[model samples]
Target: MKAKLGPAKGKVSDLAQQHGDKIQHGLDRAAKAVDEKTKGKYSDRIQSGTGKAKDAMERLAHQEGTGPGPGAGPDAGGGTPNGPRPPVS
Candidate 1:
């Protein structure tokens, strides 16, 4: 399964790199609409999830210095090419 996902990951990463900002804007818009519809009942959870999603997207896109570097390894809590995911901070 992991091997099969490699190509998909690369494709997704490429797409994310090209459309990260648009994707983030869409996420924000969706979260805001959901919050308004729910009367802020789930605002905090929605915001938190959105933040995490954006972070993951950035990582996947290799943006904002998320690419391999100091302090970026299997222990970085970001998924590797074919390694276990560390717990999210």
Candidate 2:
């Protein structure tokens, strides 16, 4: 069970690194669309969920790295070692 998950987690982590920006962008866009459609009724909840999802993605991508990438630290919400965090579409 655990052994099977190890490789799967690794692959997912790799994909996260390869597509982190795109993934984040998609999440942000989806959240924004939902919020707009709901006229802010669920804005807080949407933002909270978005943050968690982005955090998870970052954690997965940076699992083997030294620190939290973007969305963290003094320089969070700016750029990461990989590159500038892409603008939310």
Candidate 3:
């Protein structure tokens, strides 16, 4: 059966906006695995592709066509997630 793009797109956009950082993290992890499996043969390509994906996610999350809501990203002035560490020694 043919799927409707309208509802799907809206859902995806909402997800992207809500969990953009988490989504980007998963993409980075997948890219790392692929690069490792390829023994660095596709390192450059993988990095480029992962970067593009993160950029697209960011755009979706920060689009704010209707105005600002929650999830203002890192620049919200609250600092990074989980607070800071002990300077990593």
Question: Best TM-score goes to which candidate?
Answer: 2
Pairs in clash, predicted candidate 3: none
Candidate 3: segments with Cα more than 4 A from true spot: 1-7, 64-89
Off by over 4 Å in 2: 65-89
Candidate 3 — what's its lDDT?
0.64
What overall lDDT goes with each candidate model?
Answer: 0.72, 0.74, 0.64
How would the candidate models be sorted by lDDT, starting from the highest? 2, 1, 3
By summed lDDT, the worst window of 10 consecutive residues in model 3 runs over 80-89
Q: lDDT at 67 for candidate 1? A: 39
List candidate 1 stretches off by more than 4 Å: 63-89
TM-score winner between candidates 2 and 3: 2
Cα lDDT tens digits, model 2, 1-89, are 87767777778888998999899989999998998899889887888788778877987886643334556766443223543333333
Q: Give the higher-TM-score candidate: 1 or 2.
A: 2
Candidate 2, residue 37: the lDDT equals 94
lDDT value, candidate 2, whole model? 0.74
- The CA lDDT at 65 in model 2 is 35
